[model samples]
Target: MALALALPAWASHPGQRELIAEVVRDTGQDPAALEALLDGAQKQPSILEAMARPAEAKPWSAYRPIFLTPQRIDEGVAFYRTHRALIEDTARRYGVDPAYLVAILGVETHYGRITGRYKVLDALVTLAFYYPPRAAYFRSELKTLLELPPDHLAGPLDALTGSYAGAQGWGQFMPSSIRDYAVDGDGDGRIDLKNSLPDILASVAHYFAGHGWVSGAPVAARAQPAADARAVPVADARPQWPLEQLQAWGYAPLVPLDPALPSSLQTLEGPHGPEYWFTFDNFYVITRYNKSPLYAMAVHQLAQAIAAGVGDAGP
Candidate 1:
């Protein structure tokens, strides 16, 4: 839908341009201009490196403390109170829970404090150019960025100031997603993800709905695994191991699990030796973004904390 128009002249990447031109053949627009935009994205270096950082495969224990802080929880409550109207209204409209939205904001940008210091264009370009592992995917995102009309957002800077991975705004969405699902929630005729709480809140809700967020359903469960279970990657490595299969392997979930769903078996470092959980389908869905179980648990736990009314007036 984004490539249905002309894009402004841009400093294009030569090789990437040609490839994008072929890809944009039937999109009803100027292929040369689209090529130019993709070309500009092909020359960034840092973006590629960001995609392959050491943090990507870090364990859940290592990832948990990075977020899920007392400070973050306190900040989440304050953010909730300050933007209660937009958060609540967006939740009501989208059927996505409000605490999860608030928790996502808190985890992603600290309610917009540190969304990332990289220029989004440079980041996307770098990844698409040099990050061979996910190069094709990021390259498509760069295409989405160039395919959309610029307007006052015509300057690359509007979409460029964010994560080294090129995710923009409080919820850290890719530029393409921003273009597709972003709503003008504040009636300003523009969806300013960086500064508009309404837009950010609405965007968060929309993303969850797009991802099949089932409101009031459990995101994850906490349980201890038996000593005998050893992780052997199987067919559905991303999903949790089914409780039946896991029990056969001498691992039992403290709670009942849906047999139809696949699961991921994770053993976490508990206070003593280890603790474990069979991550559910929804948990795997959450990890699709970051792929770290700890990050998902932190978000799930933080959301629960907020919903439980943490402190005086839940703050």
Candidate 2:
């Protein structure tokens, strides 16, 4: 009865409500608390505004400046050194390679120094309740969150503690992904990604592995376009297209004799015409962390910068 009324706070979408109901039943959470959250969430305008400005919409030239600063590269290095053991162990365990993990951390939240200031409660609340375009998706995440394991006095809601988008902790696993992949790597029985270096490393490695990361392979390299490939339409400067598809368009191989591999052709507007690359499967693996080619590229470049012994790589 009361639970039926609370459904509106989640979303108008039928699927969203069902999932929420399932989680509430699964967790034994007071349906009333979810109602209260939805009641308060439906009133926040800031959350609505934030969703409209997906950072990926910016041009690659513009987005490039946001992350590829000399400072971020340096920080990526420092972070690598501090978490060396965990990173190495995770690489070995997941077969994902440590540099990729470090790069991902560097790009996602600047090594946790600035892991988005938004409270997870607020962002999820805003998106799930108000933003009809994506409410269904966010609401499902809320349900997944409520069903996370190790229920306690705190209940399953303790899963992720920050960001309204439901992406929290060091690597910012979305609620669903967090529940599915998070592991307590240090044997402490707590899968605390925010502060546990071991857990964060392992969780991230798990995530990449789940997304199909290839170990011991080049992510991408600077390349020129094939004469015939030059006219293919570039799609938002991302690494989504496969290599063969890109080659047909105009992107040439950067490494002369590396054989054919699946790749994406990115055309970021450079200072001159455009910066292009033939991205690989590993590059696609990075995008699973954040579904933006530019973001993954920034992280990859920063990781490379750190690995190359020419940058800061932070804590």
Candidate 3:
């Protein structure tokens, strides 16, 4: 006979009560109401499963095709054309490249066509209590969600839906990101990242600007390794070495780049063979949105494709 497992009641579950208390104590919200809200959140095992298998875990050869599809590039162009005025205006205000902004939306949620399906409360609760690895981070996010003002959220807490990690809207912003970077672009007052295009575009641009995205700066360039190329150590995506140093290390840019530019060497296993790249400060900024070098490259390439399709329509 199969054994039946008993599920813990959320209202009395270990850590759940403590999390509710923390939020209520921090925000001075009604304890009863907060308890009720948390009680309603069902722990989703699938959320923990999804978190363990993020797409970023894949190799560049496999990951590149996921976001840099021709279909995504074409739709990004259409999205830009459809919202040209708003995208341009937001980019100009934030001093970010318009194409990169479109590419972020394209890579994040397929231009908002597929935001997410899991309930935000459930996802957060599951991660906060069950996932020991990032529990503290998700616990803080849960606290933030509980403390958020009504105007900050698009709908009721129980009805809020987003990514498996509890990120919301088109850009997949966490609660902290929404609190910090989300904007009220439409001028009606509240920031609606789901239904409002202006708010979404401006929020993404604001995030990039907040993370120090330098306008008109090159993101990354293909590099040709010398026949006797010396191996360069790359700890992370941050540009800590000068281009001159990298060139001296046996990697030369395919296109001419300022030798004084701060750069980091990135090697990826491509379909053909090993691909080398000289990543710049702007590339680091893209990684601020997502730390994966593969993700940053996809956004950069997709942005280039979209910009090419849009012609010389300067922002």
Candidate 4:
């Protein structure tokens, strides 16, 4: 028998009943509590509007300036410096580059300086119920939110705020990712990515390690396309072609690559026509963090800039 209580009456949507029933079944949460939670969630029109104009859809020229600014890079370096011991320890334990971890934090929330203000429950509920384009996906995330334990979060579920998409903390991990990959690096017996810098860094490294980040491998290199070179069809970020095959097709890297190394040709719309690069295995790993090639490239470039000591400005 499903638990029911005298919940106050509220306006309902088409799928709310089914989702509430499912969540109740899955989590054994009282249906009335679930109902009250959803009832309190307000649909935000801006969330729907923002979905149509994500930064990843922009050209490299426009997108690069947004994330690769001197301020962001400098802040990333400072974050790395402040957390050098923890970052290095986490990187050694996970075999992921510390720079990439720092870059992800930089790109996601400007080193925790801007981890969004919208309530996570509000964002998830609004998108799950109101956004039809990705309703199924957001609905699944909403389900995950219901299933998350209070202890696993930085704060209470209703108070937790993040990206409009409901991603949380310094790394902006979706709720599911938080449930699976978040860690308690501070040894306080709690995983709080929002305020615990060590936990956030470790969780970022843990996510990359879980996704197969190679410790010491080149991510990508500039490739010169021959005059006769034609862009190859790319289905996804996975490195599918061997270097020998790419070289034979006139898409050769500026630096020598292993003939046996698997690679992929990524075509980007740069300010100056089509730009191509021989993206390596590590680049593909970065894509698992974010499905967008643009996002992956931004992290890559930001990591490079920080590693090269270009970001000297104090935060």
Candidate 5:
């Protein structure tokens, strides 16, 4: 015989109380204050639905066209031109390509134009409690948000909005990312990634530099696979082999590169057939910003197009 479990009698979720207690103990915030704040945060079912089907879930064929559009490229170029001095300065300081930094913002929040409309508290609460897939991680971010200083936030705590996953501001930095990597680029004594372009640019550059952005290093190159070689495409972005070994395993770059450079053979399904590319350490660094290979590729391709002056024209 099968038995069903009975629901608890509390009006609020049992976990809410547990979470409040955990936060109070870990952060030393008053339990009453935490509970009062949490009482205002509503559970969002739509956020859970959105989390289930992220854009990264799409195939490379579908994902590429979404980000590498003519309109976005044109806008990215305009943004780069408008902030040329800041971009160049930040790039010089961080040892990252200016085009790449612009592309990160362009891909992330569209150069501060579309930084999401969901309340950060609502999104973080919904994901922290309701979403079991990444509840632990989101719960940690919730703690970080609670610990954020008022100076770093622009307006009221509840007024801030960002991505469904709780990333905020122009660069869509997570709570922990903001705490670790955010900088006061404008010299106003506060880091605001939402409205402050300097802060956003500096913060993005700092993030890339922290993750090992090899200045002037090649990101990726088209590789001609050997006819008889077995395909061993990498699913993750971490470079696992040196260039010479990848070449021996049937992946040869279209352009010449140092044999000692670290690389990995990456493959994606193109409209025509299986496409191969030799991704370098710099390409892997791009993936640190976003885990998917498609995301990194889109950013790389967009940066390349911008560097080549492809504005309002298709890459």
Candidate 6:
């Protein structure tokens, strides 16, 4: 009788074999190869730790300074200058603001200076099997990563690196976002988000366009609440009320805006005191990228700063 072969360490992991079998059935990828790939993926505890304390959890006053700074704005201007033609052309192609494209890159990775430091495989596997809170979501993303064609990824599965949440490239796109929105802007027959600027910029713009980004539209406006302002509870950043209704509730935009426009009122703890903001449809669109209002605000403010710095020079 032939001796039974010993299963790999990863295969012994709970649910590991089931996941591999599902991938094999869905994608027709070789099971042996999938097992080998899983064998190479080491569970990362730090990824879980980072997830529990995300920067988005910070208060608005604390979070505001992380991405918005003089240095980041200056660097964004320089980055835009360096890739003016490609950025402008891509923005035009996708109907997105060029400054926003630059700002996303700046806030996500400091203009590609710091994409991430974790192996993509480890990050996904750890989150998928170990983190119970978002395990299903991570499991789906892990499956997507495994199913991706060779060209969609910048490198081999074992070699790819990204954020703790498994987001890749300068824009910090997850695997599903890569599948849905990533583009080969360079026309090189491959989408390399990490090393290719055309791919990176175009992918970000495509995501915004897919999420209904309105070009040349107001994102947010500071609101002056009446001394006897009616207290309004903001649940999420989605625009659910008309601007006129918000005014009746005592939150009025400091700038002129159409009363018919749909908007949401957001109150944040600012440096000095509570800050009121009337967020618009475009602002709601930005929240689609990251559910946190603070994140959207940071990106909006950063984009405005970069736009001011790049001024008449933008295309």
Score every model by TM-score: 0.79, 0.82, 0.95, 0.93, 0.92, 0.95
Off by over 4 Å in 3: 1-8, 313-315
Q: Candidate 3 lDDT, tens digit per residue, 65-99?
A: 99999899999999999989888889999999999
Residue pairs with colliding backbones in model 6 are: none
Candidate 5 local Cα displacement, residue 278, angstroms: 0.9
Off by over 4 Å in 1: 1-13, 19-44, 151-159, 229-249, 253-264, 269-272, 310-315
TM-score of 5: 0.92
Candidate 1 lDDT over 162-243, as tens digits, reads: 8888888888888677777777777777777887778788888887777767666556655555567556564432664565
Per-candidate Cα lDDT values, in order, are: 0.68, 0.69, 0.89, 0.84, 0.84, 0.89
Residue clash pairs of candidate 5: none
* lDDT tens per residue, model 2, 66-134: 887888877877777787777888888998778778777777777887666565655776676667898
What ranges in model 5 sit over 4 Å off?
1-11, 310-315
Q: What TM-score does model 3 achieve against the real structure?
A: 0.95
Off by over 4 Å in 2: 1-20, 26-28, 33-43, 150-161, 226-230, 233-250, 310-315
TM-score of 4: 0.93
Model 4 residue runs over 4 Å out of place are: 1-11, 310-315
Q: Let me know the TM-score candidate 2 reaches against the reference structure.
A: 0.82
Residue-pair clashes per candidate, as listed? 11, 21, 0, 0, 0, 0
Worst 10 residues of 3 by lDDT: 1-10
lDDT (Cα, 0-100) at 300 in candidate 5: 93
lDDT of 1 at 47: 59
lDDT (10s digit) by residue, model 6, range 1-315: 122234333446777888888999998999999988887788888998999999989899999999998999999989888889999999999998899899888888999989899999999998998899999999999999999999999999999999999999999999999999999999999999999999999999999999998888788999999998999888899888989999998887887899998899988889999999999877887788888999899988999988888784221
**Predicted candidate 5 versus true structure: per-residue lDDT over 205-228, tens digit per residue:** 999999999788889888898997
